[model samples]
Target: MENKNLIQKSIDTVRVLAADAVQKANSGHPGTPMSLAPLGHVLWSQVMHYNPENPDWANRDRFVLSCGHACMLQYSFLHLTGYKITLDDIKNFRQLHSITPGHPEYGMTPGIEVTTGPLGQGFANGVGMGIAQQYMAARYNKKDYSIFDYKIYTICSDGDLMEGVTAEAASLAGHLGLGNLIYFYDSNQITIEGGTDLAFDEDVSKRFESYGWHVQNLPDINDLDALSEAIKNAQQETGKPSLIKVRSHIGYGSPNKENTAEAHGSPLGKDEIRLVKEKFGFDPDKDFDISSEVSNFYLEAGRKSAENEQKWNELYENYKRAYPELATEYENIISGKFSEEWKEKLPVFDDEKPVATRKASGKVLNAIAEYLPQLVGGSADLSPSTNTVLEAFESFSPKNRDGRNFHFGIREHAMGAVLNGMVLSKYLIPYGATFLIFSDYMRPPLRLASIMKIRQIMVFTHDSIGLGEDGTTHQPVEQLIGLRSVPNMTVIRPADANETAHAWHVAIEHTDGPVALALTRQELPVIDQKKFASAENLEKGAYILSDSEGQPDVILMASGSEVQLILKAQEELKKNNISARVVSMPSWNLFDQQNDEYKEKVFPKAIRTRLAVEAGSTIGWMKYTTDGGDVIGIDRFGESAPADELFKEFGFTVENVVKKATALVSGNK
Candidate 1:
């Protein structure tokens, strides 16, 4: 039926191009790409429905290279299939500012589905994409009009399967019955260290099957018909995700390193590459050689994909006329536009009642969820503790694909990666919640989300030592600073119920990067907005909440629950002829973005006597405190006690703040 000779020539083109790119760069893994070339050819030519001309087509199948070290494989496919990736781009692989980086970056490359370098992250991200696909299809698809049916395909390695995050994501994918997910496990049985037998020896096929996946094992990597048939079988089974364990060699044609660990990470020598090219029936002297016939074949495949996209565009037009409202909503979501009035839906909190910031976050989330249909997320089995559950929405499970709330079980690591995947789908505003301390477990995905600059909201409750009785292990002493250290991450610690509501507003509106909301488990007294500055000033990042007469003798600054103590200390200072100003610094990242005039206005260079208070690490307070000021924060781990007692023990009390401010003012004078 198909031209077997042409297909094999195309596969060799992929292999040769990838091996040449890695050999030129001298800094990449070439084995996986060489081994997976046939599979890549089959996917691009026969399976995937992607228009190289319009790589961002909404309904096109998503491909993620989970073994991102083998990114040359994806780069070769992109170049061959005419996705705007030029030959020069492949030649400059891993060079500075090149589109072909060591790993696949979402926005940098046209066809890259997600930014993936860390082993298990892309695997989990594929799960998130599967969830998003199911959600969109369930909500938008009608009878005889399947508008949103796209499969997510990931090529994963042994390292990806061995990671715990992948295990977590695989379990959840099975539980959700994400039939749209079809992953290829490259069973090369070689890690960076040696053979996988040195460490990993479990029956991976049985493992995925036990997790409720449709499992298939292929013994040959070069069998294009078998690979195509397996993919078709995977697509037919519409009740569970499919895992095809492909037994591939590390370096398929290399003479000396075909199945060796040496081929896993390093580039093959020029001589060895020539030998491999010779084995594949190519001229040994040729480098980066691509047959003209293979090039024409892939270009023809791209033309067919473009036709498929044209058909989808026609269907979308008719669907738009039939259901104008739903179509409008869909258009808005795909364009990443939210209603201007969505801000009006934020709830106003009453200052009379004390409320945990987490609880207030829940109310704000539910209130805004009504206006924002794109908002979708869940907690890491801490919905009750983190207060992230959307009360009106049903849980997202195998039975209900349209549900907004997801139960990620106890998988914090997978939750982070999945959130990135959902956001990468370009329609959903995804959020995930867990304790602030456990953010360490999810830092890889969180960092990747920042690097990718996707719209992800990370809600972290039990923020500090104030979350006592669970002791040091549960408390987050340095998590705030750690989150702040990331390049594009916005870490917001809300002072009260009002600020908590505003933080969510900022998170939803701030589309440039990920936002981390650090909330408290203990009830924090809401600042009376009428008496103090309006909570709307929170957009300024740091604002003068309560100022004294004249230039003020000292500035008392804090965030989260400690702001209440600073407010109380201001009253005590006023009684003792001390004019102290209280400043609520909710977000350092936001504050840094402000102009120097605004930053100086909030901190005020005239008032050098400043005292900062927080119930967490004191490392990053010096920037705000300056030379004449000091920070009063916990530098050590917390102890097992009541929250009130812990606050006092950690010197996070009104008395401690007053004493520190008094001494700073005296010394400054």
Candidate 2:
């Protein structure tokens, strides 16, 4: 607090850089970065544990800009603090191919923890980081050598809080008692519509407190001492997550637009910028300029982080000597490596007895859980429904940090974000589960998961109208198609218990992106062994389950609960003296990767009469359904009725499927 002028100058430097970038780009949010300058200064300089020179340092504390539109704040800080983001990159904000885009994307930008821009996602991603922290600490840290004691700090805005996803994640963070997670709420009281009071007047601090968070309020926006003290107090509270509400103006330095809505998005004119600089006692003409001394302040901060990392390295050496096996496991977890035996342990299902994919998923989870000790996750109050909870595994709770099962209450949005945080930790295979229909509530974070390409599992059960009396609200009609549309996402809808088991196996094997396994709530009859498709074929995306006796009439393709209908259709076609082939296409993305030879062999390049059957949308089935072929799919939303009634009414039946297949084969007149 002694070098108050220098500290204030450094903070003001961030504000100017933000304003300059927004003004130069002619588009971008200047309000947040300008207003929250002091808060960012305190967190980055005095609080965060990170090395700007080594942004990928494993044990460093993570800082997520959840309100990513305020990315100028982060880009400016990274440049001044010695990261790879150059001032030129700041000048090129919102331009094509630039690291600084409209939103903070992972892999594209250095020091960005998660690809955040869809409001509320960064906060949820922070929750995931907190989960990883606890799991790693419980598994790796020794009595004296606590190597992974790092916090995940998030800076969010009113829009972030207004979004429902953050509310769900905040509740889960509290439930887990993640003391290492700290959030700095930019209480700027303004929204695009003018003031937050016009739309959002609920007590945010009280809401977080209700979730058992340690809440603090800083009265003065520019008071670094007060902000620092509140942060320290929050850090000291051990059993709860923390939220520090820092009151700030939308544009803190600008003389006229400081607290106005105009500062929220539009850049202040050059004249106004000059006036703001004069107020801060800065040269009115200079742009993106900071004194070397002010920049060096953060360099010293970076050097301290490197020294801290070196100290941790020495302690870890001692830890390895004390617990060799555990240390090895810890290293593998951090490096994103699973045991070789984990691959071998994947269950193989067959068309033998009746089995629901959800039930099979439960069995597969237990088997894989046996081999991978670091696999941790739970359901969004749908453990029984999703069949994601493994038996004999400890539940992850405030009292039991070593447990694996996480009860995310009924908050689906939070579950997805928290899992992202856990995956971001790079030490645990985190998964979340819920009914497939509820995916709508979780899509924002789920989209971020695909963008981040983190290895997280989404065990979505109650797929389609097959979920029974749970009704239309619970049924997932468009969810499958919605998930499939996302690039880099693998959407797997298993037909039976065996396929469900195989889907889980493939999901874990996928290290590049997120996997959504849609399981059935109703029990499905396992296919006959000879008639069943190879689980290995799932990796190929699509394969022939029952082929035509010759280069014959029609090809029937389906997935998930509807694959059974395809089989029934095939049987009826055989009875009618027609030879039809059946294909179980569990994952289109995986199948699309197969060689053309394999694809042609299954669908036959010459056979043009095709019929695609699935309980969901037929939008993307045109590739398989040739010019004359038909698609037997639900084209509209489902109704609130018994699962059986919905399925019949919606035409998801063997009768309709067979009729369509027969017509396609005959080139229906």
Candidate 3:
């Protein structure tokens, strides 16, 4: 039997290390870490199937601290458990260039599952991981060889549960019956405010129960035995996800701050730390002290985890020998390598017919889905409108985890977070769809995805004011600019059906960061590749669709549906004996990555008179438009009218474009 005193000492070591890290940084939240340390110890040492030496083990249990303000707890565990994280790294917490940041970032730290600071994002991310685990197990696991049975464990706080995204994710998780998922709600009764009762007074356990989750309420956070038993029970209850409502005190051992709001965010002062350390039987005078016994215990745990991975490796070898093709596919997926033939599967659009870019996107998705089995996603209850449904696949539900299509209901916020979670699996490429205007609802996760640099594709249809009749509330006037403002987020607005197909190609290949595809609901005439530049140039981000003879007098550039208007205006300009070049500028982020020479080649410095037309805000056009240039864009909300009528009323006609281009060309602005 394990010595109870040693376990207690190890738990205390975790707590003291977390507190000391915060004390050293003089920033960050300490209370939740102090309270949740026992739980962390129990999971990492006894329960979790993680090899610290190989943090990327495919079958390892995922631990997401949804309340990322308490990142010290994770860092403490990483350091003690013989991960790459060192005591020096913990000492350098929140400092520049340190592995330990203010919050846990996925790739920046060895053991962090996802980057999370915003409340409820990590909670939903865990749900996505659970879904991925379920789907993968169903797809590859034979009856005798259960390859993918890892559980996703998340420790969330009152703040995380209070966020609306968490509610949406919880509802979906319960509905899907993700039994591989287990979340520990740290019911500390305290927020940054005085108490959770100040703003949150609902019965959390009852709420989760209503969502069809297996709810277990434990009144003590320090009860390792109870926590372990609850986890085992959760693992056994394979019909539903589990929520263990752990009633923990904020700053568990602090002499004066326990259970108080003061302990929630700021570090406990040195005097308080000394008292807490003394209370916990540690050297009050020392900082960041870890006992040899606790270190050896965690190291042994890591060794056992490595042994578990070795066994899995052996099984993988056997399975590979038995099932060569499936094993090869699994290896390729985990390594983020796709067959070269998948690129050939990208659809080629017909120029004879007009099609909505969203429709084109749907077609492209299906065409490549056969070759790229890693691609899986759904729309946010707007599949019919967004055209994101995969007609060939069954919906991902409780009954069939092997299905590729996911029905995200109307929860765009949770969908975003869940997509991030799925992508974290390193084998799944997840996308979520909604109207471009509703991107505001999922902005937190979108930003987080970019920050984490995860491979997530967000399909946004009804991209602009052109999504008419729905009026201003549904129209996205500034959404494009808002998306562009996010660093590492590639926002692609295709000009036509063919460009839409190529845009998907770029998104699939561009795995360094997140990509947002803004597609139109209105049908646009497909640009004939024979007459203009080939649609393959879409990879360059901005390309000359149709160029004038020699030095052009004016450059007419636009993106999305407005590119057609620019093309029409080019003909009108030529009728008046003026040379105008039409450029399709799809993605500013991708274009910016191009060298100055390429950018200059597309928009020559000599072409001073330039006009940009788009159906959204004119904020970002100045970068391309020179001194004598101007932008034709809608700055105000759209009216409830037919899309054609609204375009004409808002000066988005060929006549308006011609007039604007004429003025710029003639220096008559």
Candidate 4:
């Protein structure tokens, strides 16, 4: 490896800058940045096409730090290449809200594409970016007019490959033939505890090759020419994703800490950092020093991207004339604006008979699927069961990139992460579905989506123990409570067909955070909107479906399948001279956000005799039930029985609800 050159000097600056920031903060992983600076320099300077002036450029190449503990490497380069991050900002790394946190946060930092910290999440996100780019190109690009021709480049670590989520995403990317993905596996062979051999010794190259990726292994990270050629070869291979495994020392310049776990985490002391600066031919005393030549070089790199963006803008103007309709649609999608015409397409299910909420959801999805070209998704091999298939379009495949529906196979974890990736730009409305029991497999991505506040739709069917005959293992006794507990996650369990339609409408239009539609497997009778409150009230989370004349002795509240039970109980209570109001509480989070006035209107303080019913956990219902109220929910696991028998066994019958309501009212008396 050449020790003295301008390129080497620029790489050294990145390394030193990262270490100095970590040392100043007395925290963060320092070894990864020190070893990976050469690769970062290559991508930001010569390889990738992105404009620091406008990081949100739609056509720009994306860079994801899958090995997110090495976030300082990205931060240092972001400052050097001028992305609104100044030298002082880098100096304030990991401090209180200084834009440089412990890990890369998506909107908190300008150039960051996604929030990454948990290993393999960013890897899956990069695969999603590749999928999104291919679909966008297939739908929007024309001959000699590449509207969306960008690659998703990523740098992952040994730990990333070890995660199960990475395997799921990698297999999908390979099967899709995502040629736009180029991942560099940083093989330092060192984990926090010790060497990779303690637990991992399998041939990763052979494994990735089996997954159908274009594989290349570089003997040394110092061999810059070899790394460049591998990237070039990866770009040329338009049939598969590429992985280049590069072996490098964890702590490159540190004399004692190099190739050791001591360097992976913890900041180098002042003496060690000063020694590194001296080795890189910088002033040993100057902590955050950068040579003027290197600074000018990266600043020039930033300016050149603006020229590229200028050309893209010019191309887009011409494209508008050539294809007016597509250009307009593209503008609308990019701006996060949608026509209200789709709202008209929402179905009215009152005329229909009893039907499963999942079945009704399928109809509502297909009704407006044509209106929004950006609305596309599939299931985790549960499309038939979850009813998430788009009837009008073909499934997206290696051969059919323009297809709207995605066959994400049986990978729930990857599907959730992929949806997060696709929806990050606000241009694509992506969704993924599976049985409610399997949402446990998707917790990481679900939490990440909420943390990022991105719009992702998760359709979870077979909700509650009512999905019977499959036993307790298949039943989701507490999944609803689990999803409801997550912040920024709106969990809606529609009562019937009409509420299901409204739920889909709200999901499609929601821009703040992810929404989970917990649909039932059993058929539920549609509530007549003409006789009761309009089904459109489902958007408000909780609504009065059926009410007593003026004042009520007791209130019956429920969600999803249990709403029908409460409705029946309301009629039964009325027959007994006990006036009970029926409240369809579809979403607790949404109702919680409502003003006190709205909440009081539904669950008034005067009416303390309230009876709540649901087939999931009873933990969260107590807040709404209050001291004078009672709730009927399955706190224990369910048994293998028919849906009707299970409901009877679990005390979800209308007779049981009537008994509970009468008892609550009598107890208040």
Provide the TM-score for each candidate, comma-separated. Answer: 0.98, 0.96, 0.98, 0.98
Stretches off by above 4 angstroms in model 4 are 1-4
Off by over 4 Å in 1: none
Number of the candidate with higher TM-score, 2 or 3: 3
Residue 186: error of model 3 in Å? 0.6
Identify the leading candidate in terms of lDDT: 4
RMSD of each: 1.3, 2.1, 1.3, 1.4
Error of 3 at 165 (Å): 0.4
User: lDDT per model, in order?
Assistant: 0.91, 0.84, 0.91, 0.92
For residues 587-648, could you state the per-residue lDDT of candidate 4 as single tens digits? 99889989999999999988888889999999989898889998999999999999989999
Give the alpha carbon lDDT tens digit for every residue of 606-635 in model 2: 888888888887788888887978888877
Estimate, for each residue in 1-669, the C-alpha lDDT of model 3 and write its tens digit.
Answer: 268988998888888888888889999888989899889988888889999889999999999999999999999888888899989999999999999999999899999999999999999999999999988998889867888999999999999999999999999999999999889999999988799899899999999999999999999988888999999999999999999999998898999999999998898999999999999999988998888888898888888877889999998888888878988999998887889887888888764589999999999998888888888999899988888878888889999998999998999999999999999889898888999999999899999999988889999999988888999999999999999999999999999999999999989888888999999999989888888998888888899999999789899999999999999999998999989999999998988899999988999987789999999999989999977799999899899998999999999999999998888777743
Over 1-669, each residue of candidate 1 has an lDDT whose tens digit, in order, gives: 268877887887788888889999998999999899999988988889999999999999999999899999999988888899999999999999999999999899999989998999999999999999999998999887789999999999999999999999999999889999999999999998998999999999999999999999999988888999999999999999999999999888899999998888898999999898998899989788988888889888888877889999999999998889999999987876788777888888864589999999999998889788789999999999999888889888889988999899999999999999999888999999999999999999999999999889999999998888999899999999999999999999999999998999899888888999999999988889889998887877889999998789999899899899999999999999999889999999999999999888888888788989988889999988999999998888899899999888878878888888999888977
Stronger candidate by lDDT (1 vs 4)? 4
Q: Which pairs clash in the backbone of model 3?
A: none
